[model samples]
Target: MQQQRSLQAFISRPLLVPALLFVLAVGLRLVYVFVTSTQNFLEGDAGRYFTMVEQLLTDQIYGYGSEKSNARVTPGFPLFAYSIYSIFPFTPNVFRWVHILIGAATVFPVYSYVSSVSRPLLGWLAGLFVAVYPPFIYMTNLFLTETLFIFLLTLFFASWQWMMNKPSVWSVILNAAVLSWAILTRPGMLPILMIAVLFLLFTRPARRLLIPYLLTVGVCFLPWTLRNWIILDEFTLLASDSGNALLSGAYPFFQENPDYKEMYSLGMSQTQYGVRVILKGFKEHFLQYLSWFSFGKLYYMFKSMWVSSTLNFPQLYMYGGVLLHYLTLLLSLISVPYLLIKKNFLAFAFTGMLLFQLLFIPTARYGAPFILLMVLLICSAAYTFWINRSRKPNYKLPAGSAS
Candidate 1:
């Protein structure tokens, strides 16, 4: 058929080999690092995360000796760390390796996601972007839950697409599992699951499947809530730290250089102090929330560009990289209209989720949802250009004759 020949020509183009090489080059660079950087400990988050897990196993409390309730942080990640600490190697070195190993699962899902949209090849770029992405690797090596979150989220995302293609009980159950797990990791994720469920309710095929989806999600959360209530003397659903998050986001406005440590020195318990800050922001500094939507996310995403540069080091090259990162992100924002016109519902929804999190907490870490926004946009551009080139007729050739 004409379509089959066209598809073949697209795949066999002169640049196909180079594009494949670019992806492989990126993967090999990231994959071989475990052997190369054997001594590099987790650069961030991994330290605090593992320490919390250590407390859970030995101190019989999540925070161990610290007066601060670990519940102020999300619980799912520490629980995962402890689970791994119990059965697997307890050394930080082994933990780093484990995180790296587990992160490998992201490759397949990222590939499948791009394939679902239009082309399987685009998935390579997306997945490779995640692998070499420095923050993700750093998060994994330490005690953070981003990798597990990504893995779980990819399943939920893929399931969402699958259900769109063919609504079935199996897809609903799969989505529920992924959603519940994602919720456990990032509290913000509960909203995302709600959106997905709502999407199902509104869609033609999934509307009938809402009840079963709800029941499955309920089953997942009940056990965790019950455990917390029995052991922690709280009727907490997952963790008891929303008050602290609210405070952390708000307290910076009351002072020039507000620090979490200052709250402790001032004798405010973590949860108590944090709650007051959140309330204070709402009552007095409500404008910060709106300001953050426009500038805070822009600033944080601006900073996230540079993996090495900081206000501390300020290396010229690193600073340059940092600026480049946000510049690309800004381009992504402009392309939103183009994507929307193309009916890229999945990318739009994903960006919407990030937008929600940014509204509440606009930090570089919180901006993780925009993982490959720039890369995908550029790759899609390349593919579009290639397809256009492939469609051009040979004007110099004889009419009605093949080139």
Candidate 2:
């Protein structure tokens, strides 16, 4: 009986659910990794990242080659790869395994963020959703920035929630630090930081720590900006790829026009040329540009899971995954008004992020990081529904008098 009670106690521990979710997450990802072990990792953007890591190792440079260091891409992922390659042999399987671990560990923050705001059971559900999400598992197989960026992004949300709840100096600093790393991982995330700063300025409990938060962010960003300014002779805050991103999005359906290429061939800076193309496109095709910016980009962003070409899966699974993606998005959108009515700050920040992505090229890969957030919102809505239903008084006809 004592042994039985001890087992029950262990089972009832607060962390047991998240721990089991983490194990399940790791197991699922491991199965996928081993099955796809023979697949090539150096595909698409992975090749560019691999090349950057190679340059960092042998040439001690961060750019494409030894010619000159450029800020086209941020150093976070390459540095992450470099740290791994420094210890282990540069092999695809090793990197994938490490990424699998990093990807699986994201479950904790998802659980923490959800559990803090709602019940623990909903938190477990959110973590499970992340554990089995198809695109998140597939992302670990590629040597791209998505895995690391997603992990950091979730951690940022978790830390932000923690600071809001407790309002400690250390938590404030930690939130700022996570935000800095997130921006460095994906320069597009810079706007989210601005949104956060604006939110904090208005929030009472967190307003006092805003200066420390900004100072910490500035401290974290200083070295990278200084490096870009010194080596590339440009004051690139995060990266120099925004121009290409703008140009890519300037066209409807991302199809480049001949005039865009002609303008680029005239030796104009990419940023300037991209701006000109956008202005011209807006002037020439106002309605088309408006639709593309508002709804078209949103449709493409959440349409499908970004699967690896080499990893073959059943068509049923792909269809089901896409169906689930749409369902989650729909449910999350339905929950937004509820969240706003309750004055949820995180909801505003997340909505701001979704809106901010409209300014760039639309790709499902960009939406992968927010899968956890969508799951959290869905679980929150579900939990609220369950609670409301349970609280309702049961009504029945007395003595079956009704017909």
Candidate 3:
């Protein structure tokens, strides 16, 4: 009864708004998961990812090169997929189920961290936002490494901040591991390179803390990098996929079966031809990149974060989430000063997170939508939670307490 009473007391604390919001987030996400991922596993990236993992285990093929019969993601997804696959060998659907569970579980850490910054209600609101967002929910059904990578990224970031506030070697090591794992899964982080490392090294009074973090993550990456070098022959730091993706995104000719007005290479399929033509096309289309990074593009990209994929397609309509995104971004903007003045470095760190996504995978595919949506979700939750506290009236003064 004592522990139960204590728990109830904790729950009843004035900030239970976040708690309620968290539950709502979970409920929304659960509905999404059931709608999308359950019993229906089909083609596209999700199927490709699951099959790639099955290939890794059944055949010795590490890199699923585009040789008419294979597919490729960064090594991280397939390797992690294999781990998930081993547990439920009978069905790829099992991993799909696991993806939904893991993706749904992301709400907790996301809520807790954002909640820590402001209120538990804010955390819950953030969680609720994530719970319902389609980009997150859509990805949950596939075997993408992004699912695990993001969850750990959120977890490590929260823990890293907690450790920085409190200071501990274990926290440092865990942060390093999480980030390194993120890098290993998707080498796009290789572009951002050492932001996290530099943060650990030079940001603190206890400069000694940097040693364990760098050393731990370094130890982890050494073998991984060495293995890459041995296999891919170049100074392969992480994966061998980005070159192909960049080629595909930069030029329209790289589509699955091009117009064939211009053949870039002989004996190469449409995909391979695109990858081969990427460099030349980039040189020719250099102006397109400038347009991509322009103020207009950035604004549109940021705005797109809140809008539904359905908006682009016109077949599916759900605009309520879009309204929620607008509110979210406004609140997040409000919190910017708080994060800066209050020494919430995660706010700044998250800027780098956005930048990392921007610099590498600027495409509007599954990767690009994540950035704006995340901001919108976090901000909207803050606004909703904030309004409830400020505007809502309560008259529950205790026995001896004065209003």
Q: Model 2: per-residue lDDT, tens digit, 38-98? A: 4467887788788888778888888843346888888777887899999998888889888
Model 3 worst lDDT window (10 residues): 306-315
- Whole-model lDDT values for every prediction: 0.62, 0.80, 0.58
Q: Point out where model 3 deviates above 4 Å.
A: 1-30, 33-42, 66-73, 190-193, 249-289, 296-317, 330-344, 364-403
- Assess candidate 1 and give its TM-score to the true structure: 0.72
Once fitted onto the true fold, the runs of candidate 1 whose alpha carbons sit more than 4 angstroms away are: 1-45, 58-70, 251-289, 306-328, 338-348, 359-361, 373-403
Say which candidate scores most in lDDT. Answer: 2
Q: Whose lDDT is higher: candidate 2's or candidate 3's?
A: 2
RMSD values for the candidates in order, in angstroms, are 7.0, 3.5, 7.9
- Better candidate number, 1 or 2, judged by lDDT: 2
List, residue by residue over 283-347, the lDDT tens digit for candidate 3: 77766655543432345445654222453312332565556556655666665555545444555
Q: Estimate the TM-score for candidate 3.
A: 0.72
